[model samples]
Target chain A: MSQKVTRRQFLNYSLMGVGSFMAAGAILPMGRFALDPLFQGEAQGSMITTSVKAEEITEEPVKVDFSYEQQDAWYKSEVTDFVWVYRDGDQIIALSPICKHLGCTVTWAGDDANPNKFFCPCHNGLYEKNGKNIPGTPPRGPLDQYEVGESDGFITIGEMFENELV
Target chain B: MLYNQKDLKVLKDEIEFIDTVIIPFAAMDMDMKAPVHAGNLELLQIVCVQLEKQFKGRLLITPPMMTVGEDTSLLGMYTTQLREYGFKNIIVLTHLQAEPGDMNKIRLNEIPLENMSDDMKMEMINDEVKTVMKSVISIWNQ
Candidate 1:
């Protein structure tokens, strides 16, 4: 014989289902947060925006400072980087500001006597217009060069590869 | 470059070009409390690290020379040894003031970093490093 459903049993089943639904609603987000790293892909290098335009650049390099979001493990922060960007004919060249000698930032036309070259004030290091380290300087190599790209009048800089410039 | 095995490995054969040696001199007072002693040592380490980073290729940072009392003849002996090893510039960056001497013995520069904010300390460190760089370049030019 088929048994009739009692109100107490029906209410107990519905309450249990509702309680389980509420418990899952509280725990699912926590579970996802804990396991989110497993689903994340490898950290990819990204292009960063600069306040520079291709047409605005001239033979004399301009110092363009920009920042990017740097993700390190679980910590995230914004880091500032700079480059010396200038136009060489139709090609845009971007040189890293870091000096090859000791990682100090180099400045463009910093010396009054040598106004066309990049100068590192820390150790009197000098670099030529093409990012080549001048002989007799402390720097053992040339400044790094960044892969530059442009679209719709805006310029974006990619990774800086060391001693890339000729 | 620090006085570590990895840095030494690359620089062992290239010591002739690495002419500058930075000897960090900190005074370790026996009467002072442990925390104060630790704090001073830590501050000196930070300052030295920043200085080394600014002139890594040209400067070789030696292990710190600590003094428990007021004696500093050990620094003189150290300077002589570095000179024997062909380092042209042996700079003693001291928290405790070093004795003024002739240019050949050891160059002394006091970095009074006590009771300073981190920003101020960093600014002072950068300034000191720039000065040291200029002097080292002058020596190289000579």
Candidate 2:
């Protein structure tokens, strides 16, 4: 049997198609804009590019400060972070400057007597070259470590892992 | 450094290195008004945090001494206690216009929020706290 196509039916089908296309065109951009942040992953644990370069890292730990945008719901602000970056033979290490005993910022060599160790000026807490808490020191645990990734000769510091030494 | 268990332990073990103790003295005239007292307490806390951030290694921040309906007469007692704990340089940061006799006292007020936007006021507060803390550091050096 031959199928009959009426002019009214053909017009209805064409109008429906055109209406759906227009609706999609209007809705797609708005949908993407509303959901852009969700696709960017959760704001808390994202890697941020640092000012540190792989070539600049030496045996002596260098204090590198970087800022990244932190989003708390609708509020967004740049949060500054600092790390002690150094090279141990073939490996690159990035340690957080926060002291384990207290939240005081630790320095590469803040103490005159303990010039080779990472020193916390607040309480004289010391960490070894490998970020290990010196035995008999105030800090019971080692400094937190930043997961590092390298691309295009620049280092990207990621989420912190507490008590991660060496 | 703050007056927490971990920090106190650190202080006890390395008392020789420590020379300063910042005692945040927040005295409230509770009879005045609830909002006023709260505002005073809030500003004191902000100044404390700024000072701790600025001179973490050089000083220990004792838990705030908040005396409701009290005055600066208690300053002498606090100084004596802090001196016994081996703090040579004691700083009392208060909202009350306290006189510096035995210990250094700094007076600060909250940035008035009546005439500015919340964001602008917050920025001003931060700058104000930082400036006050820098002056406190200079006083400590002297």
Candidate 3:
């Protein structure tokens, strides 16, 4: 015959484990839920236009400059700036020339001799002419893309957010 | 504050002593495909890092404040922040690019030189100088 287990013994043995699990379930969501606002308030959209005539955008990528309003949510402000625009077909897109690694404005620094890639003078962040992150460079991700819209013969660009900037 | 080594050298080589540091609250280049100019968290990091290097010893680089960060309803907060800073540091505003709603990094620095006084204008030319020294200040503050 097997010895019978008492209800009191079971409660004493498992009480802590059950309570800890309950607490975790209650806390995890609340923690994540609270920080959602931070994510939502990252940054908002802006507009940019390209001087590249609609017919001028060739098959290759070209960097253009455009300006528009910036909607800051944290302090509730509206500012503007010019962005570098890249054109691919009728779709004219813009990317911030800033090196992704440390936020240095990677101007048209020209090409490197050995690799022929654009370099950031700040920390030597590298990017292909197309703005792709060079391997082993400080910038870990690809350049941010802009939304494009054409009106008449002119091209317009918008900000990129997450995957889609607009 | 934004600068490379040359900027710092120029300051030390030329204006060895600097009292007032004017950090222009405007993204230098916003319209680009690269992340650095995209005006995101990375932008803030880069700016802060640069500010630290330039103002490493004594400076006050404002927080990465975005004009578009808040809604129009809270413009007062931004104005207050400016006022809090004594409004002595003027804002070098820029013209907005078209289709701003679709893009995030179209912002660019188009400093209004005309609006600024002679002294204020000089501050911008040596902005890199300011950037380097302020870098030191930023590091200490953090």
Candidate 4:
């Protein structure tokens, strides 16, 4: 047996098929928009990876440079900043290099007299190896700490927090 | 500290702590040396920014002052006004030969930054900044 379709039936069938496709094309975008928040949760991690390895940190603090995209008003630029990192036993600790009194960059043994302390050349501020500000100096508090983690043998930095080791 | 709205607001009551003011002076001659002037201004701005970061608690960086030539008569008037406003030190940072009355001037070295690599440029800029910083510190000590 052979089956044949009339012109009226063919026209009606084609119109329904084309209409369904157009309807789907319009509805899919709206569906995705409604579920957009669910997809954004995965990208909320703010951990920035650094070029240094996790095993490179020693007992003495060393400067570690990290770059990140900074948004300033209408400008977006990559800013490179550094932190003092060291290993305390089995834990990795990272301390902010900004002086507590001012925003000067502190260096490890920057002052010749202060060989084992972080020294700020501006106003002669000093901090111990554990980031505790020395008494009678300009600094009023300990150095701030950065959240650190290791991923694939590389060190990653996250948000800053108050010094917990001090 | 800077000459922005937020810093100025705090500066009103903390003038004693932030007594030093750095005025970045530059020239903008639209002549054959325009590119050289522009490069010098860029380097001056970078050094000013680093100085601000290192001495935010005690130093105030004013806006960059642009001029046409070596005429710095306006700077003298500005310095007098700043002194009246309780600033103990008024240092002019520039890459030009300027003499603004008794105000201190730190002349920066003109480095050819165009033909250098990124690392070399950074090292050169850093060396320049260190020398400028040392001068500022000595002035403070005096």
Candidate whose TM-score is highest: 4
Better of 1 and 3 by TM-score: 1
Q: Which stretches of candidate 3 lie over 4 Å from their true place?
A: A1-52, A56-63, A71-78, A89-91, A109-116, A161-166, B1-142
Q: Candidate 2 lDDT, tens digit per residue, B1-142?
A: 7888977888887666667888787766657565666777777787787667656766788888877655666778878888998988888777766575887777776555556898987787788777776666577557
Backbone clashes in model 1: 0
lDDT of 1 by residue, A48-145 (tens): 76777778989889887779888988999887677899999888999988788756668899888899999986578899999999999888899899
DockQ (Cα-based) for each candidate: 0.16, 0.24, 0.04, 0.46
Across B1-142, the per-residue lDDT of candidate 4 in tens digits comes to 8999999987898787777999999999998999999999999999998998778878889999999877898888899999999999999999888677888999999998998999999999999999999999899889
Model 2 spans with C-alpha error above 4 angstroms = A1-81, A84-95, A99-103, A106-145, A150-156, A159-166, B32-34, B68-70, B113-118
Residues A12-109 of candidate 2 have per-residue lDDT tens digits of 99999999999999999999999988976765446677877889989999987779888988999877778989898888888988887656778788
Question: Which CAPRI level is candidate 1?
Answer: incorrect
What residue runs in model 1 are displaced by over 4 Å at the alpha carbon? A1-44, A47-93, A97-107, A110-112, A120-125, A134-141, A148-158, A162-165, B32-43, B100-125, B131-142
Question: Residue B113 lDDT in model 4?
Answer: 94
Go through the candidates in order and give each one's C-alpha lDDT. Answer: 0.75, 0.78, 0.48, 0.90
Over the stretch A11-99, how does candidate 4's per-residue lDDT look in tens digits? 99999999999999999999999998888877657778888998999998887888999999999999988888899999999999998
Clashes of 4: 0
How many clashing residue pairs appear in each of the predictions shown?
0, 2, 69, 0
Residue B20, model 1: lDDT of: 76
Candidate scoring better on lDDT of 3 and 4: 4
TM-score for each prediction?
0.61, 0.55, 0.37, 0.82
- Candidate that would win on DockQ: 4
